[model samples]
Target: MTKNGHRPKIVVIGGGTGLPVILKSLREKNADITAVVTVADDGGSSGIIRDYVNVVPPGDIRNVLAALSELPEIYLDIFQYRFDTSDRFFAGHAIGNLIIAALAEMKKGVFASVQELSEMMRVDGHVFPVADEPLVLNAEFSDGTFLAGEAEITAARKSIKRVWVTSNEKNEAEMPAAVPEVVEAILGADQIVLGPGSLFTSILPNLVIGNVGKALAETKAEVVYICNIMTQKGETEHFTDADHVRILNAHLGQCFVNTVLVNTAQVPEGYMDKEKYDENLVQVEHDFNGLREQHCRVISSNFLKLKNQGVFHDGNKVVEELMGLVGRPNHELRHREHS
Candidate 1:
């Protein structure tokens, strides 16, 4: 419950771009939102920062902060600004990411720094990293080979057999567990959202944490998976809606997802600019029968939003369905309080 009163607590567990899209919508609905972000990224500016500071990559964290921040437009813009490539010193870095890195050093941990920053940004919700320590994503390819690091795994272009996270490069057995707050948030949530992000890299990196995976299986909360809008190349290249959910079950060792939100909207033939939407390899074919066979309640809709020829989930539409799934809110009381 918020200081205002009772509100639906929705814990969204995933990282990357999709997490923030839904979050931006849910914030307006006054839900007590908690985002459990993945920190397994080892590419681009995040990887650079991680190598330098030994703190969890702050790129995803920075995006989540911008999404949930109730700050002025200019401030958020400046926070998100990335320097030009020609600028050697600051090129490829988001200002918000740098701020988070500084805070991590000052507070002695990522969690405390985020907690303090959330208040400073006047965030309407809580943001928790999946693990307190840095987690390196490791994958076994379908061809019986192995790879480490998120960038390498994706670039290999082989079908992913399975993925897991560990804290140490020297010892694979040393996997970091999820912080207590992360598990507690999922266990106590009224609703939990699984994805809309990269199946292997963005989403799994978070769930591969031992306690986070276990909590999903044990939590009584309605676990709703917002299926990805488009198939991701080198990851979910030929995956179906059911395949996505199946991967989640396999990772967690149980069929934990209670509901699946899928997009029924069709993408025009060759409408997607391959250069623009590089990762979007194909439309995820619907497998309603397979979902039913897996005991999942499927709710399909035209939940599509096209921008620059890239397919994205209609965040507002999806949240409406989620809100209804959790039961009707006390609109009169909520309105009174907000007003």
Candidate 2:
């Protein structure tokens, strides 16, 4: 337990770049970690693999696996390796995608494939795809022209009115069984964290799953939403901190979440060069009165950091703040009052 007391079991739900970072940081602690990642990814390497092979996109899963790997630097290079130039067999493919696909084929189930991969990576904890099926995320605009697939939904220039999931493999409207261990982790967790990733695509995709949402709503664990450092141009465009919570609560409803973690440190001016950062940082704005009425406590901290050519939550800072909330009951202690 890293010279500390018992490690808290944590179940982090999300996908994309943020989930890996979250996992990487938490793995340093004494927590039993489980990452429930989204499988709706249909961009780049993951897309190519899913289209040709008809399996759940494994890009995010691959990333999470690598992040939790004991030999991350070595295995990550191998797993993340992409073909430098388009080729016949390796065109736009990640080595990890091929590895996961091959494993899924050999093992007969995505769940088993990931379990095998997790052991191979020597990850500190567990990782599961939110659903067992190849999910096609659908977003309906206010105009009623619905867009399907994560890639297509992201390409839409307009803001989405609502988002839901459907199966890419014919008429499969339901999500695959929630990995049993994931539900167990939630029910047994001391703290559960949501995003620092794309709200709809990365974060909500997991929530749209039936049992995933139910587990999230039913778990007595203290739920924490780590607000993104900046807004994505096509996704969160101009979302405020409060808007982030509003949308998540809207999708998962009030029963699922009890607390929020936000970056109180605004990006220093000019971090957003037109040629560089997206130039859209998330501003802090909370529905104080309403949130208080609903009993959802908002936790804020200066946890932003510059990394990997984009802004992110400082790994150490995130873990420190999250660890503070670990085992701490959902009390009405004010953010300032606690400090």
TM-score of each: 0.94, 0.90
Model 1 RMSD vs true structure: 5.4
lDDT of 1 by residue, 63-126 (tens): 9988999999998999899988889998898888899999999999899999999999988899
Off by over 4 Å in 1: 1-5, 169-171, 328-339
Q: Which candidate should be chosen as best, given TM-score against the real structure? A: 1
Candidate 2: worst-modelled 10 consecutive residues by lDDT: 330-339
Error of 2 at 132 (Å): 1.6
Clashes of 2: 0
Q: Rate the local accuracy (lDDT) of all candidates.
A: 0.86, 0.77
